[model samples]
Target: MAPSSPHRGVQHTLSSRGLAKLALRFFSSLRPTDCPLNCLGKARLDFNLLPLEGELHCLELFQWSLLYQGSKLVATQQSSQTGLQFLHCVMELQKKGIKFINREVESFKNIHLKDGTLEIPRLVILDTAMSLFLNLGAFEQCHFNCGNDTTTYLFFMDDLIDYAEQMRHLHNCGIMRHGLESDAEVADFFNQICKEMVLVSSRSYLSYLSKDVNTYFGNKWNGWIAILELKYFSNPWSIISLIAAFILHLLTLIQTLYGVFGYYRPSS
Candidate 1:
């Protein structure tokens, strides 16, 4: 007869029910002040544990973990606004002199816009990303008190990426990296995940960021500057040609003025 398997005994000892009971007991032992959020908040307030500049604090780390766990902290405010519908695509924003900057962070909350520059954390998309986001979105929809942060993020990305070109722009800017076959696939992934999802703009953390971006995009001066840069200063050759033309025009104007002065008041 074959020897009894030790692995089988270990598996039997760690049954699903036993694990569930252990988790329940662990949670039950925690006091009201020991909740995850409360603990993180307390840690954040501790001066000794403060992180240096360019480092993430305790609460941010906790929020990042929650992001990967398919949940998020609840928003304190709620408004009747349906969702963010005024966001422009990547190319359009670029044409409006709105620059995209990669924050090089892993947290979803690391997105913000300041001084016409919109900073976003880098997003890595692998083969499993689709399933992961879909499952997270489903959980948010089904679980009570689970905010739709992930869904809102997906919607925001979908709005930014309208086609393959936009996806390529994001990849080139280091704001997104993907192992997909083509840029079109990445764009399609965001579009597909955001389909049929309801978004409350006021509840989304990116609402203010979006407003700031839109305000920058709406500025006529920015648009004019973008057009000038794209048309006349796009390359070294173009810039040199513009300078030469301006000099020629100035010389011609000066010559014409000198001749007019000579004609009006004859120089003896």
Candidate 2:
């Protein structure tokens, strides 16, 4: 994000990258080139004319920009029915008397617009894991809210998700949009991000949500019923197979009783 603000002894640390000297020279060059009086106002400096070394510094800045940007939205793997499926699920939930509620927290970065909707000023970009973590760490230090509501969301995701199967479960339930190459990648992303984050306290907004979710599954009957439905009758073919099995069992029981009572023997 702003190159970590040129920390004390950073020159020594950045020496390996060979950008230390070039960065200072680039800044020094900016004064003579970037700030200039033109016909209307100060002329926009042409970055193309800079030396190769200066260009490298600019490249580094660009990398920082991506890392400092907003959280990378995980794109849905199936793009075609994304919107339709999301709407269908919402309507189904609504019919079941499920309601969506938003809790209004005192947010430092959330902007209240004229429409009465909260919006966060964010820039989304893709970058390496190391770069993303470093910039996020820097952003946490600078902002009291620690990147606004995103911090809370990330913390929640970290606690709820731990493995590839867990990520897939959320995706199947339409709760998560999996954009990575694999479910493992999504799991790795959260696992790594949690390690990098500086959590303010142990308690978070999603603490109740996590507890409720766990409690729901903790009920023996609830978990068993869910397992049974998903395991035996999740699809049309599975339901058909279950029905066929029930019918076959009934017929076999009738035949066994007929033979035991001699009903099928000698026309009895």
The candidate that wins on TM-score is 1
On the 0 to 100 scale, the lDDT of residue 158 in model 1 is 92
Model 1 Cα lDDT, one tens digit per residue, 102-172: 87543465578877788877777878777666766776676534566777778889989989999998888
Best by lDDT: 1
Lowest-sum lDDT 10-residue window in model 2: 79-88
Off by over 4 Å in 2: 1-125, 128-149, 163-185, 200-203, 252-268
Candidate 1: where is the Cα deviation over 4 Å?
Answer: 1-83
Instruction: For each candidate, give its TM-score against the true structure.
Output: 0.71, 0.40
lDDT of 2 by residue, 1-268 (tens): 5555556445644452455335534543222112222322211112212223322334333222222212211111211121111011222222222233222222212222222111222211223433644554555545553222344445555654677876665555544453347877877787787686665433233333333444443456654565676778679998999999999999999999988878546562
